[model samples]
Target: MPIDDFDLAIAPLKDLGGQRVWSLMISLFGDLARQEGQIIGGPVLSAIMSAMDVRPEAARVALHRLRKDKWIASEKHGRISHHSLTPEGRAQSQAASGRIYATPDDLPEHWLMVVTDDAETGPLEKAGFTTLMPRLYVGDASLPVPKDAATLPGQAVPDWMKRQLEPASLAESYAQLSDALHHVARDLAGADTLTPLQIATLRCLIVHNWRRLALKHPALPRPLIRDDWAGLVAHQRVAALLAAYPRPDLPEIATA
Candidate 1:
């Protein structure tokens, strides 16, 4: 591929942990196959990974690690291989899918908040609740609150609560991603047709960057969301690009 053909709009994802081969593999499968029993054949998996510049040996190692960690399971049919997420892995991925693929129109009207003076707040934060304060966590109504914690129903969102809902830098990050998405869109529009490898590469990068941002912020209601926030625009552009470059056939993505 020529240097000009590739668009690294979001060239450097800052402050993120180095992209691990195993983690990227998990993200790929979660994006592509989580709904379809998370099953993928060896050749197809390899082809997609290769499109993203992953080495075959590195993929093999990552697959082994995922299986050992109980995140994935594999089966063999003669000489060919197939892999699927383990039950535990599917549950984790499904939980995250709600956030990653969520639309503004689908947001709930009410929210649930758990306030306690105990040490259970750590678990709540890990489970996707946004920290309103030291012992306070706010989440959508669907979020599960601890049995002993007091649940508060959202009525009118206060300014203080909205301020605490998102980090100061989050809005800026959304603007940056929106800009990057626009660049990618314009670049893709000029192309006649993208090869399967090119399509795979572009999709993977977009998904990876978007996924990180999506998971970083809690799902706040319109009243709480900042007027200048660019998340909605970024998501809309990403959806359109993904639609235009639908996943290519396995054979077309294969390099060997």
Candidate 2:
């Protein structure tokens, strides 16, 4: 994986408590390397607490957890215990760095959309619509009419449809629509029957507007779309949909 891709993976970890510990560990290691080439336990803990603005007790707990997890090792030199990243810790950190720095191809499809969404300048601008534009299909006339006449049959509209109805206050609607698209994309990406093409499209949508999705749905984690891997199964669902609704023109052309 490219460095960029690894960064994307680590992006989610930053929100977890483990991230604080990881940061402190890295910082202490770097400082020790620059100064004495190694850090003893007491100084390591103090530096970590001071740099992280964490309580000494909290820093101690984090250090204990890291040691327990085997991310670091300690050896006694006379009276002081010197600490450093273990071989295992070094390997894990390198692996994490690769994940954080991985190339785009190593990244899932939805990540493309996320990149797009991050570039827009407006309060309600959604990203990657060019790749995964929603298609609105009206139900047949036999379907019950909506109580709101504005939503009558033959008037199917894209997620941006609300913009036409309420132009002046469309920002709120844009936020809602962007969020709904992210939800739909996540659902489709995780489904068992979506095709590769569909998954690709969904991934594009999610990557572009994940923040909007989180903003509109505060209950969702910011990295839900980025970290989830269930999207691989959604290809099966797309295949099923394609099988159920094969292109009609192909049959007619073959017959002709």
Candidate 3:
């Protein structure tokens, strides 16, 4: 069958390592398959290694690992061994494409919320507090504080707290949290309704961009806006809507 666009997107990753190694493996496989009907033994492997600027032994090890993992199947034809993807290998390639190429629209609605608070509270209370922190609380009191009480310099006066604080670090942390919430909302709410894959991608994006966002908004009080709880409620509503949708089998590629 002709390769699908999604398959092509994940083709370079079949060996399942870092981008460079994956690309090299894909390239070598393509070259060998195209030049000869099959690939076998040291010479072909050595040429692939040279092309990739990796050692021959490294290439041999990678090839052996791919074979052992059942990513490729081989048959001895005379002195040469021909290798091709097994049905499982083809399925794996397709799955990788679904994971890396499918947009949030392809995912289903369901969200995982991670709530953190400075105080120890019941799970239900924590959920409610995260949802209502901005509107229910007054002024700066709604702001997130260090969880460690011992870290408090004194009586916890806001002005004194500001002076003692690292404004840059604070802003960075708040920005990181805001960015994470934005993604969670996007993925949990759905393309039409939230999908797990979308949620996961959003979560991943949050982790990836966290440091930069944090640096940009250091020391800013949580919920810089008094109406921040409204957004959280909106998020909750979206999650509920997604929950109403029928759940699909979580795709294997989505794990980890």
How should the candidates be ordered by TM-score, best one leading?
A: 1, 2, 3
TM-score of each: 0.72, 0.30, 0.28
Best by TM-score: 1
Worst 10 residues of 1 by lDDT: 9-18
Q: On a 0 to 100 scale, what is the lDDT of residue 90 in model 2?
A: 66
- lDDT: which is higher, 1 or 3? 1
Residue-level lDDT of model 3, residues 1-256, one tens digit each, is: 1223322322222222232443345433432222223443444444334533466667667767777887666777687655655556556544343323222233322212223443344442332222223122122233343343221212223443333333334443443344444444444343343343333222223222332232222222332322233322222333343344322222311331
Decreasing lDDT order of the candidates: 1, 3, 2
Instruction: Give one digit per residue, the lDDT tens place, for model 1 in 118-219.
Output: 865568877667788878877778877778789887777776667657667666777777787787787667666777666766676666767877877666
Window of ten residues with lowest summed lDDT in model 3? 130-139
Candidate RMSDs in Å, in order, are: 4.2, 21.5, 16.0
Q: What lDDT does each candidate get?
A: 0.71, 0.36, 0.36
Candidate 3 residue 57 C-alpha distance from true site, Å: 1.4
Model 3 segments beyond 4 Å from truth? 1-48, 101-256
RMSD in Å for model 2: 21.5
11, model 1: CA deviation in Å?
A: 6.6
TM-score of 2: 0.30
